[model samples]
Target: MRFVLKHPEQADVEKIESLDSVKGTFTQAGQFQVIIGNDVDLFYNDFADVSGIEGTSKETVKDLAKSNQNALQRLMSNLAEIFSPLIPALITGGLILGFRNILEGVQIQMLGQKIVDGALAFTQNGAPIYNTIVDVSQFWSGVNHFLWLIGEAIFHFLPVGITWSITRKMGTTQILGIVLGITLVSPQLMNAYGVAGAESINTWNFGFAEVQMIGYQAQVLPAMMAGFVLVYLERFFKKVIPNAVSMVFVPLLSIIPAVLVAHVILGPIGWTIGAWISDVVYAGLTSQLRVLFAAIFGFFYSPLVITGLHHMTNAIDLQLTADFGGTLLWPMIAFSNIAQGSAVLGIYLLHRGDKKEEQVSIPAIISAYLGVTEPAMFGINMKYRYPFIAAMIGSSIAAVVSVGLGLMANSIGVGGLPGFLSFNADRWLLFGLIALIAMVVPATLTYMYGKRVEGNE
Candidate 1:
């Protein structure tokens, strides 16, 4: 007789083979065929009854399952998975905003206008200033305005994308998610950005209570919580409703309760939570101890990336950008990226003579510089302990300088050399200086450490 085991174990198979009643046994995958002279039916019955072994309660099994699951890790992983697809859109919008800043924010002295007086000179502080592209050219101004269409879709209505992504990740009805997201940011409701300055908020008056007509807009936490609520409701309705009329009732049952619950309970709670977190982070970035905060954050960022905790920063960055117009935290993150890449560059130089090591190091260096550092980190830096230490030290130094000088990025952008484009126009030079430090310090330290280790060897 052949038997299939749900949770197959080699020890169980060995014990079964050792039985006196068994002649021989053959096993493949989870299935086993035993040649036995004893009664097969009796043995099968006894084995099936083993699950009822004394003193094991359902509560004990539940506790065992809970102990095995790392809830926080799973939550972070899910948040990462949900946000992965949105990164490209966010980067594109950030770069566009940066370009807009350059066109409008930077000022240049018009030397020729100073030479030729009264040539319709534009002056800032009595010096003749050259008109920016947006000022001089109607076409560029129009282009700047045109870019806002994409920016608005990506950032202002970000909740829509977040909800859709959550549905896609959770395997729910995506249309319901989309509709639910739209409700949170619909034009019928007051825009979240405008709520603070408004003299009065509009509300719907029910006989017993009143509901505020406010939108979530760019809020992340509320959309995430609401999306999951919709997902769970959809699943619950699908299970209880009959298949014949499930199409009609499931969506109706799922979306209505989900939407009501979102606006009534989850939305307010999520907003408070998101706002509180943003306030705390913003305070940390601007506090007297900010330099110390930056150093610690920069030093440990690489380790956070290894554990998948780095994904949480995406939400925080977005929140900071929404609340405070920019984020100081992301610049430090970019510096850490550059520092790790520089460490890998040191490894590449050390391994130039070895073709095999060069092949791995070259790609790792390029990837790390482009804002993806996993290759350089795990492949090169982590392999050589000194390189990782050198990177953390470099990153810490750069981050201290960043917070000290009050460096801030307009938005999240490419996280390596190109990251400077995302900085405030006035801080471009400062960002460049910090980037240089991030590169030079890590590379120099790593190379010197490697040479010393080689000499000892």
Candidate 2:
């Protein structure tokens, strides 16, 4: 339904009417594209400036855009604010892993085989890399052999490891000092987790971790021990003086004892639990129908998105990584998100519609651009009322292809922009390509199909 305002004193009224025919949205110049499908008019009209209480054309479009512009800028700024807290620990860990990958790659090339060859060249363009490679073999050999000599001492030191974004807060000078002081010199700490180096390693595989899984600390003993320790630690720390002032001595005082305790108690115990959890999942994944099971799991994966069951995916993924050193979830999910976004882009392009139809499709397209699919999923595609079948035809095809790719994720991250990094070095390139195919093929089909349906009032 095309609207023409007849000298309407309030131009917003004409906009309000013009967008009425949309699935539930609107577009307006110099303001946030209006979403007028619901009580949007009620909320927007509440704005004193837009309300036209004493309105005039002289009021300017800027008035219509005020609140939204503020909102958009704040969202952008807040995202920037979070970068410092998040980057160091996370990216540093990834860099270390990348270094490890480089070392492994060199070692495997020496043996003339690899667990996975990222790139191999016998003839790039036409001839051999034989002499060139042989010349560099010594360089590769140095990297390969040096990795094992002091890998942990250099790489896993708490100060260094904590530099990773995930643990940046933990690595702070203050926290480090506190942790060390309690662990060392505190006799009670030495007993709970076995004391020496070898004992520490065994405790991870057998001590607290084993006790939690088995009945070593019986039902009552386990619960009671947890409580008593918490109470004692809570009280013990309450009496302590701040150590930052004692800077020179604090590191010495805090660290020697804390390292002992963290090594014995926290790291090993956490590793044990993490390892145990990993085993349970790894066992399940590699069992009877590993591929088929993976495929089936991938199939159900899409719905977790719609129902918000996506968060639980973390544990499942942790297990996968523990078992396979990485797992298929990353690529598959990335494909899912990308395919859905592509389908939304499809609507924007192929949704030949009346002005109203165009209005709805455009904003849904906007949401998809920022990586929100629900607006497209629940609002338009499903409600397009005719092409529902076509979108599924796309999604299902994408799911099957994802299963085939054997796509794997080495580390975990979130949706949207961060997820783009997930595709790095993961074998999911094929799944990503499949998503592109799924989006284009089905989008074309859906558009052609929707084109044949009725346009609008």
Candidate 3:
């Protein structure tokens, strides 16, 4: 970690240099720079004691944390507001998708297995028992197909739902956004997905510009963008047009321009951007740099949580699944979360004799293992210092190992124990083993550190 100190005094320079964790310090005139190679927390706490350093006071730290939260909240507020209404549908779709994947995995796993082979000799050439298992398999197979349809129905037309949601969020006419969204993905229009791939499809020139007609099924950014356009244009028309004719003219104007712009411009732009991110991430995951990629993300993930930047990974995970049928990052996040929980467990073990400490640590462990790390992180690991660092190390190791083992998740949600539902079933065992390692390594390291610090505390 590096930070600049403006107008630093001689005493301030001396104080920072005294900290052993400060790897390097440089100064030119009144400007000072310090690099902490390890123990960023120590630097933050110690440097705050310096006269000119801004964030060392308790109130400053609290305010800084709040400021970070507000910044992140504002960054995501609009998108989150739009998505909040669709959460139920998203949850339902994800659960069904997970169930379908699991059922398919079970069928594949049982393909070569023999069930009650001797029972077949006793009952009508074993047809009864064989038919029973076959029937069950077929039953699940049918159920999985239905579940797939249920999930796909929501996922395929997500653009429309999101558009409707956005319009509501923006306080605009929902009907116009809905119509724009439907027109974007309409089957009657040229297929948006396949248009670029096919050579036979021709572009339409509207005198102003030539645009290839395409649909927007399974898209999100375009729908949200069109909502923005509709909201602004609707407001404009409502302001300028007479109320007698405004209702019809506003909807008509909003629908036409919004759909046109989304289809002709924003839709393709968003698709290209999403596709580029997927390709870049895929390349990093597939290449030799993958281990480094996983380690960096895994190690820094906890810090991202503090700043609320972790939410951004959700989009990346979804895009990865869309392009590659699975996501490499979700497993890394799982390992990181598990590591934080294990670190809290370590802190708990160290304070075995103290009921108050144990009480705090116990729930933290549970919360972290449940894929919510805030309790474990702020409650125990961050407080202990060494445990947080140990957790980062453990998570980084596990992430690199996971990448090596080719562990991946089919979707992003239900991490920790329920993470199995998101995992690629073929490598479930491998994912579990890596997660276990992530837990054990951090717990052991933090426990050892805690033992040494126990009496001192």
Candidate 4:
């Protein structure tokens, strides 16, 4: 006799060939599985003599849950691997721009002329602008201009790095990835930044259709989608096409179609999706309910990091930076990082005498303060459940303050104590205030909570 198990919610029946197969599908729909027959042992002789079938079922469910969790962790790990190499370049660019902002945007008064004596001067909007570092020092002015070359290469050509990195991660053709990325941001195309105000965009007129000659500078989604498309195409071609001529035709076929698909279809779709997400997030940040939203987001952000969903914020931040002059979301992320670090610091203080705990907590605290929170989160905070809660509470309060005050960052930068360098010079004081809150609240709460928990124990 064949047995069938019906899922109550899904209303789908699964055919059970044996007890082993049923165990495999035990957790498919829900936590519990029921077998309704006195002849259950007849299905499997090995399980017939087993006395603890209920316990075995529970173990199977736990194993399935663990397997699913491992799968998710692997997915998140791969996603992080794609962007991990780009961090150094992004940080370097952010710091360079921050220094440039100090040089060019800051104003000082000297000798009663609103500037240094005999310095180079310029007029903007009919007002004489002066007293800036670049305005005063010729050497610094040259350095400022030089730094822009590196900055532009980092930000403007970011898609190239992303695509190349994707190909590297996916084990596809890296050279083809570089070529595909270049086509998206070619100088011959109209700059993506100027698309807003321009009266007309250049196009390629091919008798039947005209393709817009637009670039995808600083875009994240288009490059990523296009890179994967290229990877699959290369794989497909290599499988079918004989090895005798695979080298020449595989890359050629893979790149050309991928490029065409990117420009003609995927690029616009990706752009629209990215823009829509940015608009929704921007609306929330600027809306009347922004504080509430920030509170919820801040509290859950560390948890999101644990699940690896926090990686999506990179795309959103890049889109916000492309659409608006700056991103308001990243500063909140920085606050969360600080809050988690502070929680770990509290743990460190409580376990100062224990060398084993000190070895884990010290590095975790430093790593969290430097914008990477997995160490603190998993090693210390998550291990001590109360500390994680304390960090979340602290992050929520700091995020509320950040959104309420309208703090904005010029770009995504270091997300720890040094994160203030990424914010606008005008908002530095406000960022500092929130950073202090992020630190103090989590540490104080964790310390208090830890003491109570220890006392109870």
Off by over 4 Å in 1: 1-69, 111-130
Please give, for residues 1-457, the per-residue lDDT of candidate 3 as tens digits: 3333322343465575556554335431122335453366776676677746555453333333333234545466455557757756765666676667666654332344334644332345643322222335788768877777877667667788888887887788887778777887787767655765787765678898788767766666667677788789889889999999987798887778877788778888888887898889888877999989888888898887665567667667766776677788888888899999999888887778865566557877888887888667765676668999999999999989988777877766665656776664556788778888988999999999888777577
lDDT digits (tens) for residues 1-457 of candidate 1: 4544344454365576557655445432223456443476676567558855333353343333333236775566678779998999999989988988877766545522322354666456676666666776699889989988888888889999999999998889899989999999999999999989999989878879988989998899999999999999999989999999999999999899888888889999999999999899888888998988898999999888866789999999998888888889999999999999999898887767875556557777788878998767865687677999999999999999999889989989999888988975778899999999999999999998899899899
lDDT of 4 by residue, 186-277 (tens): 99989999998999998989889999988999888888889899999999999999999998999999999999999999999888888899
Candidate topping lDDT: 1
Candidate 3 TM-score over all chains jointly: 0.73
Candidate 3 or 1, higher TM-score = 1
Question: lDDT value for candidate 3?
Answer: 0.72
Please, what is the TM-score per model?
0.82, 0.47, 0.73, 0.81
Any idea what lDDT model 2 has?
Answer: 0.44
Residue 21 in model 2: lDDT: 40
Q: How many residue pairs clash in each candidate?
A: 0, 7, 1, 0
**Model 3: residues with Cα > 4 Å off, grouped in runs:** 1-73, 80-88, 105-136, 174-176, 190-199, 202-210, 238-247
Lowest-sum lDDT 10-residue window in model 4: 21-30
lDDT per prediction?
Answer: 0.82, 0.44, 0.72, 0.81
RMSD of 3: 10.3
Best of the candidates, TM-score: 1
